[model samples]
Target: MNWQDQYQRWKNDQDLEPQLKEALHNMNENEIEAAFSGTLEFGTGGMRGVLGPGTNRMNVYTVRKAAKGLALYLEEQGMADRGVAVAYDSRYQSREFAVETAKVLGVHGIKTYVFTGVRPTPTLSFAVRHLEAGAGVMITASHNPPEYNGYKVYNEQGAQLPPAQADQMIEQVNTVADELAIAVKDQSEIEAEGLINWIDEAVDEAYLRELKSITYRDDVKRDLSIVFTSLHGTAHNLATRSLAQAGFDHVFAVSEQVEEDPEFSTVKSPNPEEHQAFEYAIAKGQDVDADVLVATDPDADRLGVAAKKADGEYHVLTGNQLGALMLDYKLANMDDVPRNSVMINTIVTSQLGKAVADHYNVTTEHTLTGFKFIAEKIEEYNQSGAHEFVFGYEESYGYLVEDFARDKDAIQSTLLACEMAAYYREQGMTLFDALEQFFERHGYYFEDLHSLKLEGTDGPEQINAIMEDFRFNPVEGAIAVEDYLTGKRTYLESGESVDLNLPASNVVKFWLDDDTWCCLRPSGTEPKMKFYFAVKGETREAADERLKQLKDRVLERL
Candidate 1:
């Protein structure tokens, strides 16, 4: 059906939800068109969109359709008896959507273990494995804005659904013809039938117990004065509690952002990737004379850090910098360096980490953009024993030190960052100093990311046009091009082609002269096209200049 007809159908429905009905009555022509243009795309990342009453939004009906699709997929796989785990963060309507998902699954005779309250995304990943569920569902948008919400599905391995399985699930989701027509049992009815199991502290304690194993040192100075903020998301309690339990004596929680505020009133955005998100934490850090400042997103799956410089100013570290720091620290402190140990990162990540891994004699592997790909590699290593997984990270402030949770874990990363800071403080150094040392050794590797927010009906088309333009048009000074969509790497000089040996994705990377590289990829979870640039030079000034030139040149073409 056309969007106009769909909008009218929704407008004429007598039994429409009151909130939706009100929203429909208030929407303008453009709003109506945006809402009914098409169904929200449910791919490997599951569904994420603005929370409203529309096929394209993240309302209860859309969520129910997703749950029903997952239910059908599970039943088809004959794994319904194994049940599914459900968790949500502190976003608005997150709990309601999570319960709605369980209800839909329950009506299909599928058992569900649902968290009673807010939990981090990584904890949900852990619950899938700890409960031995066939799959897992997380109601979150990660670090999206207040108006946004999302749904992410995970497989039995406690990892987000990889491409192959995600394709199957997407087909099932597409078969769900009508969003509003899916049936769901009442919460009470599901509870009485023993299909809904409420999980709380038992799982929390289990997850915390497993987290204890991530600590690498017992004698590291725990007196590191630290400032932490959850940005009014789900990690407020657990993050602070984990620090205390780890014997960190001087930890200060940003009081303004310590509670669960769905609106995230304290900050403009809850994403730890942005420097603005750490305003409250930075203020608290200065007040307490903290050795380091840490912030986690609403779902607590990504971590961000800022360290006090010698000049007494706080400097926010990029995701790559923090990843390198953590990897170096972890490898240096390991009692035995296994010859077969390997570190994993995405194609868009900086090569500085690989240099760090190389120094420790630990191999480094590259995966696609998503953490699910990294988790897949970890699972493969676990099964074949070809390599032991040490650490996994991406360029988007996501890191997983231990594989206890098959996703980026901000809680454990926070602990380790604190420990690393404390250890460095004992040597009269800060994280900035440590990072500078890495640069001096690794040739001043600098990196930056540019995200273009091409949203709405024409957004996808425009993004595709840009991708096509870059695919055929060779950039100046480029030596080779790696097109993940074609799974081929072509050398410009020799016209030789080779396989990337990685999963096919809509990503294009350029290898330029002077040890410079850049990548272009669309965000799976957001309506944005991201440009990642990295360069290496003998000095910081040269590296910074090269990085700016590369970034400006690439963006000008767009």
Candidate 2:
């Protein structure tokens, strides 16, 4: 059916929610068309959308449908007997969604473990593995605005379902012909029947126990002064507790954003990717002369840091810089660690991390642009015993040191960052000075990210057009192009194309002369097209300028 048919169905339905019916009655034809034009597609990260009525929205009926489909998929996988773990963030209707998911799965006779309250994404991943469940669900949109919520699926391995599995799940989600027909048990009935169990402190304690192993130097934590903010999400107590447990004495929390708020009252966006999220943390850091400022996104899966620079002002470190520092520290300190240790990072991340890994004589592997890919790699290594999993990170402020959880952990990252600061202080050098030394030894590598926001309706088409332009037209200053979707690299000069072994994704990267490169990929979690530029030069300033030039040249085309 077309938009008109869906709109008519909504208008004629008696079971539709009242507010949604009122909104639909008030909407114009164009608005109605947009709302019912298509079903919200579930990507590798799962479904996320505005909380309202429509095929494009996330609501109870939609949640029921997704859960029913997920249940069917799990049953087919012979995982119905293994059960599932469920967790949620502090988004509006998040708890409702979590309970609703449990109800649907329970009605299917699949046992479910639901958190008693809001929790982080990594904890949910850990719960799946710890409980020996077949799968997991996290009801969150990560750092998206309060208006949005999401549903994420994890496999038995504790990683987000890979692309192929996600496609299978999506097919199941699409197969539910009637949303209202999805089976669900009464909440009280499910609880009484013991089909749904509530998990609380035990999971948290086990997760923290795993984090203790991340400490490289016990002495460094004692002297580190760290400021951390959770941006009004679920990470407040967990991060602070982890820091103190790691022996960090002087740690401050942002008072205003410490409490759980679905609206994320303090900051415009809860995302760590935005520098504005660090405003409160930065001010507190300056007031106390903190060694570093750390902020976690909602659900505590991503980490961002602000450090005091040589110029005596606080500067936010990009994901790449922080990843480099942590990679170096983790690899160098692995004196007694397994010799075949491996570190994983995304393809779009800074090549500087690869350099650091090479310096430590550790293998660095590149994956598709998500922490799930990194987690998948970790599971692979753990099973094969061919490589020891060391560290994993991505360019978007996501880092995982210990695989206690199958996802990034801001709590673990915060403690480790503080420890690194203390260690550098004992060495009589600041992190900024250490960064400079690193640049001098390795060639100066600077990276810049440009996000082009294209709002609703035609946004996806516009993003696709932009990607198509690059795929067809040879980049002016590029010597080669790596198209991830086709899993091949095209060399312009030699007219040679080599197969790239990584998983397929809609990403195009240009490799230029002089160690300069640019990459283009649509944001999986937002309505934006992201461009990444990396440049190398003799000095940091020169490299930054070159990076800016490259960004300007590519963005102009967009």
Model 2 misplacement above 4 A: 18-30
**Candidate 2 lDDT, 146-193, residue by residue in tens:** 899999999997889988888888888888887756778999999998
Q: What Cα-based lDDT does every candidate model obtain? A: 0.91, 0.87
Task: For candidate 1, write residues 331-443 as lDDT tens digits.
Answer: 99988878999999999999999999999999999999999999999999999999999999998899999998999999989988998998998888899989999999888
- Deviating ranges (above 4 Å) for candidate 1: none
Report backbone clashes per prediction. 0, 0
Residue 411 error for model 1, in Å? 0.6
Number of the top candidate by TM-score?
1
Worst 10 residues of 2 by lDDT: 216-225
